[model samples]
Target: MSVYDDYEMTIGIECHVQLATKTKLFSPADNDARDAEPNTKTHQIDFGLPGMLPVLNKHAVELAVRAGKALNSPIAHVSRFDRKHYFYPDLPKGYQTSQMYNPIILAGYVDAPLEDGSLKRVRIDHAHMEEDAGKLTHHDGYSLVDLNRAGTPLIEIVSEPDMHSAEEAKAYVSELHKLMVYAGVTYGNLYHGNMRFDVNISVAKKGATELGKRAEIKNLNSFRSVERAAEYEFKRQVDILERGEEVVQETRGWNDDKQITISQRSKEDAQDYRYMPDPDIPPVVLTDEVIAGIQSKVPMLPGEYREKWSALNLDKSVINSLLSNQDYAQITLEVQEKSGEASAKRVAHWFASALTASDNDTNDDSTQTMLYAARGS
Candidate 1:
């Protein structure tokens, strides 16, 4: 007899995390590689050079598995890659390598805060490893494609349609972002396009087995967009239903400038993309020992860190700043290790002040940067 009596909103998310690797997923371009000129970073394999062999990036696999464990997803002993066939200027190979049938991480949950001071569990369906497509820059009259990102390693974490409200969906994304930040998955800087999310939303009557029509909002780079887009869609669809109109299933693009979701195409009109196994790459067979070892390598994560720090009732501002950046979390832990747990809060306060305040290459640079590095050292 709550809000459920009026409506039910089901939600799912697909979050793409770029691996912070020293090199590209398959090629040798530096991690977070950027090229000013189009197709400048191209390698034969990256350029879809004929008969080129792909050697799996060892670090990419390990980081994917490690992050999967942090998400509490079961490790798949064997995972395979698929060819998602599509044609776009940004796609150098005319296809993308991703996991479709089976993924690296199976099932998990991300706990999120609720409006009632309770917790809502965001169900994670799977987290799969894949390669990112290139970036397309559109000019006034033409478009150019940059291949530097063509082969970058990306881990796509998908969630079940378990969320019931826009707020819940936002918290879910924010929590996952935090977990990724702490685990070194990616920088989660939407402004820089380091991490991005796609939201799938559907609204239904309070009691209904059949779901209402759905719309997909693509590449929402910011957490605010994720929530606002969902809320906007919910209202738009609900209004349609109230007017006794049929809501068609379709994919849409977010017009960030207008703060609205615009239809790209009806779902049925979209291409199949003809998924098939990649003929070039071999199946990923992860042994049990390797899985366990990778799991062991992940230290206590954000949830655990939060629990341990709660006893001190630390300042919310300090906690917010610490959680804002994963690097700060790591620094806090290191400072605690060196200064002792009893004095951890005091050390963290000073560190947070410096990190949030100053810039590099100034008078306070050497000493503060050393204090920052000393925690890790």
Candidate 2:
């Protein structure tokens, strides 16, 4: 066996999900800031103008509570925001409003289904509500800052160091994305950066009790990128250890073209952030009744969706394809209910074939109705 054979990898993920709301978290600026002219969606609060105070968006709070229920995490009756001090062009304010002590969602577990049809439970540490920073684009001469996204609502889901393989990490992220979209948490828009992942990975000896130093791959925007980055980082760390050198704790960015990770900056510890409670915003007060109301709004989650799809007895590939698209999944379920199980299979096949033939978006009701008509014929 090679030197790498004696090691195992451990991975923890920090996932940021942008909440789908019309307005920003604290500011009234439009949350659909993507594609808009730079800095057009900004308000006084988003710009951190003098004498500005934040007003927590009630809709964002409700969505966060609903998200907690979807993740199988209990909602906290009281959760507050804290200031995470950092300086960057993207950050209009010197600090990012985040949660340090109390968070909205507590401990939970995600049952990630592997390719072998087996499940691995990835334990969640906590999920907290926060405001996203703005976007910075670097030009040859200078960097341009867009404050439109500065105050967008987000829930950062921090998972325990539970993943061992790249496949496991991919599965967990896939399941998490499905759950978030299915429960109306976010739009699940990858291109628009609706969700992004920060993967922290470290390797240890096969029987070693302690883990080696970890390097974090920051802001992985795609599921494929997350898996590929983990695989690359795992090998990189193993190679370093084999050379009798220690892996440095740092933040790295993935080079998609090179399929390698480049060092960005040294990783900062928690103390480096200088977390303090935001004086401008008060603690969110969630009562039992309020939480119950939010929980009631959560619809069918991915696990439940899988269970129902399994009963249809369709091909596994078809079932998976359907499950990933909420619109298609709902239409398939409705067709099954109306036409019976036998017709459901025929309709699904027709729908799948039509989609393959046309390469059209299945999110529209018209496309589904056309498939239904074709099935009837």
lDDT of 2 by residue, 171-235 (tens): 99989998999899999888789999999999999999898899999999988999999999999
TM-score (C-alpha, index-matched) for candidate 1: 0.87
TM-score of each model, paired residue for residue? 0.87, 0.95
- Which 10-residue span in candidate 1 carries the lowest summed lDDT? 355-364
Q: After TM-score superposition, what is the CA distance of residue 164 in candidate 2 from its true location, in Å?
A: 0.3
Model 2 weakest 10-residue run by lDDT:
354-363
How many angstroms is residue 200 displaced in model 2 relative to the true structure, after the best TM-score fit?
Answer: 0.5
For candidate 1, write residues 1-377 as lDDT tens digits: 54434777788998999887877777776556653466666677788877777767889988898788778888899998888888876766788888888787889988886556467898888998888888888899998878877888999999999898889988888888878866767766666677889899998898889888778888888778999999888888877887889888888889878988999876643248788988777888989998998778776676777776776577756765666655566667766767767567865676557655233123455655756565754
> Candidate 2 — what's its lDDT?
0.88
Question: Candidate 1 regions off by >4 Å?
Answer: 1-5, 139-141, 268-271, 315-317, 331-342, 347-377
Each model's lDDT comes to: 0.78, 0.88
